[model samples]
Target chain A: MKTLVIISHPNILESSSQQFLIKAIPHHFDVTVHHLENEYPDWNINVAKEQKLLSEHDRIIFQFPFYWYSSPALLKHWQDMVYTEDFAFHARGKALRGKEFGLVLSVGINEAEYQAGGREMFSISELTRPFQATAEKLGMTYLKPFSIFQFGYMTDEQRFQLAIHYQQVLTREKDNSLEAKEKWIMEQLTNMDKASLSTDDKIVLENAVESLKNNRHTIDELKLILEQMW
Target chain B: MKTLVIISHPNILESSSQQFLIKAIPHHFDVTVHHLENEYPDWNINVAKEQKLLSEHDRIIFQFPFYWYSSPALLKHWQDMVYTEDFAFHARGKALRGKEFGLVLSVGINEAEYQAGGREMFSISELTRPFQATAEKLGMTYLKPFSIFQFGYMTDEQRFQLAIHYQQVLTREKDNSLEAKEKWIMEQLTNMDKASLSTDDKIVLENAVESLKNNRHTIDELKLILEQMW
Candidate 1:
């Protein structure tokens, strides 16, 4: 899939987490990393260029560090400028229709803090409703956000795992059916034997494949039973 | 109450609604209408000046047109810059603690468009949770946001009424108890008799006073009954 990762950090060069993630993005997928602050230092967004980029991509990921429970000003400015009525919503046709929207946030605080009774007093899901609304308005599928909290305190191993997880999230097919998703995972695991996998990694993959096979079998049996009843 | 209305419109001079609202702010309250875009044309936020303004005010009102389901980029910029750790949340003494934070949004779309099944697909309250979370973090009271939607479609009479309502919202005393608020309203009405009041206005004020008196009586009775039961 053609993925456009719009990174909106005011001082991205200073951020180690962002640098690490950018480097970790897999080479296979056609990805464009458009840094907003770098492109528009004066906050003057090129609307036509942004719209063209959006048209060229299937999945759009907004990657940013959460500033004061929201994104940096540049992202919002980009939205205000790029997602105009003629381009995004009330265009000649719906420009972003069938596109997928996703958010990848690196927050300063710990994940535990962003809960109902916690210090932050709201979940990441609740805080990112504006993005969901925008996606909904433009007829795009809003995916569940990928949030990395307290990145400054993360160990190297933890950061590596997070990058791998982020890449998986970005490249994953937008398959709605559980059966299809299970099949896809199984297929991926089956092909991974060629890769120089560790013994522990092989065992984990085998276990996942086995669990998914069982699930698929159960789902097939249920479908057969429903057909028979009908 | 000392109210500092931080108006963060990109182009406030062009907006009739904002102009009308700004003109309507009563002279009685110590109101500071800070035009953010005008003050910071280059987006270089004066952090110390903003912190000083916050310290000077009892209530800080974020007055802006809602852009992409939130305030404009400049407002977010202001938040990121001015609301620093040492100023807003983690100073020797909490600067924003015990103060009030309020939002006044001028939206282009109608109010109905921001409901569950509407085009926007989220209520204003749900979307503005970031500000609420900010307030929670800073130990400030997050007041109910005042939203004026579809200003272009509003009649002159409706616009006039909105300005009056806006003024009332800004200047209203932060009284915790119902009795104190009722007393304040009664006092205001008593003083309003000296002004050249229309018959309908006089009748409305009288009815409001009567209703408040009845409400106070009922509340007093309930308190007495609760005290006796205890």
Candidate 2:
């Protein structure tokens, strides 16, 4: 399924978090990054063009930095102007039905600060109810949001892992079972460009693939035994 | 304390709810109704002017229809541009500290639908956490929001009562005691122009003022007795 990531920021050029996210998305993945502020300088959005874009993608993501505990103003403006009654929610407006909606947020606050007694005094999930309600009203599947907290402190290796996790969220189906993850890993290995790998790199890749297959076989056997007993 | 009601609607001329709110605000009350769209048609907000307006008011209310489970884009834009980090928050900025912040929202859906197992499946309080978080971060007192649900279904009498409730939220202190309410009633009666009333109207107004004072006395006595017993 194709994914559309609608990115919005007041100043994109200076934002390292936004830049990292854009660079992290795999080139081969079927994802489109639509920069909102760059596209509509005057806030005059084309409804037909936006609706057509929505219709083409199976999954839609709103990606932005958390400003004032919510998204930047332009993204909210986009929702107000594009998702009208006749096109998004009325009797003849089930155009967004069965589509998947999610958020990719970059929070400047610490993760521990979002809690009952913490500085923020609420969870990120609690704060994002408005987006969930919007998705529910439009008959879309609401996916768990992906949040990056305190981007200034992350190491390079962690950022690379975040990118891989982000790619899975965009491309893979919404399943967290061990069997599904193993299947996804096998598919990724199959899709790798082996011809471009050096001899040493190819040997390491083959060994990793063999180890993953052995783990999957053991996991399936254990699952079969447990299911039979139950 | 003075109050400022910043009203925002895409088309204010056509909204009966907005009109009713503006008309219902007591003329003698120390309140200013600032229409956001009319004030900034070009979207270029004057930061100094807005901060000055905010500093003058004790109670700051955002009055608008609940669009997409939140305020319209203009309100969010106002927040982003006007509420600068150096002016509203940070080490030296405490301009809004200890002031009251609240929302007056007109919801299109039914009240009963906002609950578990209901159509909306979430209360209004649960949905407005973002606003609450904003108020907390700014060191402002967050008041319980005043929501007008299903305006098209409200009767004239209900609307009038709603106006009274709205007025109480704006002008009164953050106290819900019966004695406080009775005191407010007496104050409103005192503020009335008794000279403009006919003989019968004057007698009725006099009786209401007397009754409210008597109730306040009775409430104080009861509270004293309960305190002694406990």
Candidate 3:
């Protein structure tokens, strides 16, 4: 499926995770990456160009590091301008209907910090409701988000793994077959026996699952690929 | 009690409800009405000016029409800018603590559109969780939000009444001794008892309660003042 990733980072060049993701985007996949801040530095979003881009793609991903628990200033400006009345919304018909929307989010806080009793005091899901509501209002299908937590302390290996996982989620088929993808993830992880693994082991297993799907290779093959990645 | 009404409407001059509110601000209330869009048309918020303004007041009112279930774009920009680290939060000497934070929100949807099965599919309070969360984080006391509903359909008389009510709420104190405000509202609109009123009505009653506590004016005397407001 054709995918359009709208990167909304204020400064991608200064970001390790964003740059890693940018490097890992496979040229083989039908993908187009649009850097919103680079394109509209002054916050003047071109509504017609944005609407046309949306019409041309089946899957759209909003990639950004969560700032103050939301997207950056440029993305918010894009939402206000490009999603205006009589264009994205009250148009001839619902122009954005049936398009798929997903978020690729990175947060400085760890996973534990996003729970109910966490220091940040709100879950990533709760903080992301505004975007979910936007997708709902625009009649687009909202997918489960891809989150890279505690990005401030990520090791080089962890960053590489995250990029591989992002590539998997981004280039997935847009047809109604994500349940198959979920089952594929379950089978790839070490053993389906969930009670034995520690939290860190589970994350490794999950990332392995994602990488296997993207490369269409087995977990053993993924280990071999990672061994040769450098 | 001193109050700071920070107006965040994009175009206050073109707004009927907001324009009326700005004009009716009482001279004796130590009120300062700020037009956010006019001040920061280029989206460059003066952080020191904003912090100084917050320091000079006991209550900080965010006055704006509800846009996408929250404040407009410029107001969100203000929040992202002025409510920064070392100022609104995490500062050794924080400025926002113990201050009152309230919203004067005007929504286009009617009361019935915000119930469990309403067209909006969420309660007004639920939609406003972000603001509440912001207040909680900044160590500010969140007063009940003042809302004017069904703006697209209200008659001229109703709009005038709304403006009068808006002025009353903006000037209300943060204490609990304003019981007569509730009683007077029930007298004005005898269609329903006070217990069954909507969220918008609750704000007006609370404002009246606040006004009574601060001004020490009888309900009849306040009525006479509003009657001669023109």
Candidate 4:
């Protein structure tokens, strides 16, 4: 699916997580990264341009660093302006109906701080109800939010895993099944540029792909059996 | 108690509810009405000035029309910028600690549209969780939010009642008990401009005040009994 990641940070250059996520867009997935602060320095969001962008994408993500338990001022202003009543909540037709909506949040504090008995005293889900309501009103499918807490504390391996997980959130077929995961991983592997890899690395990659193909075949047979039983 | 009702409306002149609220401050209460849009036409809030105002008030009410299930963008930005770490959440002591925080919301939609099986699908309390969490974090008391729904649909009697109820929300002593309500009503009645009223109206007002004084005395006697029993 084509995805649009709208980044709403006051200072994009200073945010490491924003850079990482922008660079982590899956190679084979059609993605557009629009940074709000960079696009509208004067805080005048062009509604027509934004509406056109929303029309072209099936999955839209609002990516931002959480400020005071919500998005920054510009993003809030953008929502207030661009999502006009006639365009978003029309009686005959909503412009964004049937589109997928999601939030990619980068919080400065640790994840543990956002729970009962924690310092924040509210789950991220509870704090983000407004966005969920907005999606429901517009007849959009709201995806489970992807939150990265304390990105500065992440190790290299963790960062790598986070990138892959982020890509899965963006490109998956709205399923979390092992079959679906394998399908996505297999696609990524098959689309890899092997020209830059060493001979040993290419061999390893080929073995991995072969193993995935066998697993995919076995899963298909199991599904067929289950279908027959039903 | 001193109150700082920070009004955050883009067009204050256009909002009848806002204007009604501005004229609803109690007679004997110390209230400073600061309209953010009027004060900061450039949208740049003076942190030092806001900090000073916050410091001086025992009650801080964020009065605004609900925009997308939260305050307008400027209010969000005000919270973000004015409530800085060194000032609001400092290690030494929070500046606004022990103060009461409340929300005076004016929703354009009907009240019934914000409950289970309704179009909004969330109560005001649930949707305004961020403000509660913020108050908790800063060691302030989060008062029950006061909402005026579809103010334009209200009758003149309803509007007058709203003004009184709005005053009670702003000036009540953080309780909803009958005794507390009586005490507040007594205060307002005692402080009224009786000189402007007709002689018959004056007599009626005096009798009401006399009845309230007796009720207050009786409540005190009951409290004494309960205290002695305890």
- Listed per prediction, chain B TM-scores read 0.80, 0.95, 0.74, 0.93
Q: Please report, as a residue range, the 10-residue window in candidate 2 chain A with the lowest summed lDDT.
A: A178-187
The reply for model 2, stretches above 4 Å from the true place, is A193-196, A225-230, B218-230
Better of 1 and 4 by lDDT: 4
Q: Give the best candidate by DockQ.
A: 2
Model 4 backbone overlap count: 0
Candidates, ranked, DockQ: 2, 4, 1, 3
lDDT of 3 at B54: 88
Write candidate 4's Cα lDDT for B107-166 as tens digits: 989899899899999999989988999899899999999999999999999999998888
Evaluated against the true structure, the overall lDDT of model 2 is 0.91
lDDT, model 4, position A37: 91
Shift of residue B147 alpha carbon in model 3, Å: 2.6
> Model 1, residue A106: what's the lDDT?
92
C-alpha positional error of residue A2 in candidate 1 after TM-score superposition, expressed in Å: 0.5
TM-score of each: 0.83, 0.96, 0.74, 0.95
Please report the TM-score between candidate 4 and the true structure: 0.95
For residues A30-55, what per-residue lDDT tens digits would candidate 2 score against the true structure?
Answer: 89999999999999999899999999
Question: Looking at model 1, what is the TM-score of chain A?
Answer: 0.79
Model 1: per-residue lDDT, tens digit, A120-154?
Answer: 89999999998988898899999989998888898
Q: Write the per-residue lDDT of candidate 3 for residues B39-122, one digit (tens) a residue.
A: 888988998999899899988898888766766777777777788887878856578899888888888778787766666666
Candidate 3: global Cα-lDDT?
0.77
lDDT of 2 at A67: 89
